[model samples]
Target: MEEKTYKIMSGSGIMNVIMGISAIALGAIAGVMLIYSGVKLLSNRQGITF
Candidate 1:
């Protein structure tokens, strides 16, 4: 019984690490996209002249 419990815990720990890494990767991608869009908007030089 003890051996089974240890195996389960080890498996869960690995899964948690994988999930954390994936979440960080996704967040970094989203942050980069946001910054790119913001810079594009800021650099637009066309102004409406009426």
Candidate 2:
């Protein structure tokens, strides 16, 4: 019984870690995209083509 409980607890912990990492990665990607868009807009306004 204890072993089964341990297994379940470990599984839950792993899932939480995975979820946290994914969330962080997604947030980083979103931030980069936002910055890129802003830069693009400014460049367009300046008539500088990339």
Candidate 3:
């Protein structure tokens, strides 16, 4: 009984860790893309005439 409980707990712990890592990685990628898009917009604005 105790062995089964330990296995289940370990599996859950590993899943939690994996989820945390993916979340952080995805968030970082999203931030970089946002910054890149903003820079692109500003760079293109200089070429526009009023």
Candidate 4:
């Protein structure tokens, strides 16, 4: 029973690490996209028609 519990715990830990890394990567991608859009908007400020 203890061995099974240890295995489960280790698996969970690995999953947590993977999830954390993926979240950070996703956040970075979103940040880059937002920055790019902001820069584009600033450059085209006079072309906006709304």
Backbone clashes per model, in order?
A: 0, 0, 0, 0
Q: Write the per-residue lDDT of candidate 3 for residues 1-50, one digit (tens) a residue.
A: 99999999999999999999999999999999999999998989978788
Q: Write the per-residue lDDT of candidate 4 for residues 1-50, one digit (tens) a residue.
A: 99999999999999999999999999999999999999999999999999
- Which pairs in model 4 have colliding backbones? none
User: How does candidate 4 score on lDDT?
Assistant: 0.99
Candidate 4 regions exceeding 4 Å error are none
- Candidate 1 residue-wise lDDT, 1-50, digit = tens: 99999999999999999999999999999999999998887787465245
The local lDDT score (0 to 100) that residue 43 gets in candidate 1 is 80
Scored by CA lDDT, what does every candidate get? Answer: 0.92, 0.96, 0.97, 0.99
Tell me the TM-score of each prediction against the true structure: 0.85, 0.85, 0.88, 0.92
Q: Which candidate is the best by lDDT?
A: 4
Residue runs of model 2 more than 4 Å from their true location after superposition: 46-50
Cα misplacement distance, residue 25 of candidate 4 (Å): 0.2
Regions of candidate 3 where Cα sits further than 4 Å from its true position: 47-50
Q: TM-score for model 1?
A: 0.85
The lDDT, on a scale of 0 to 1, for candidate 3 is 0.97
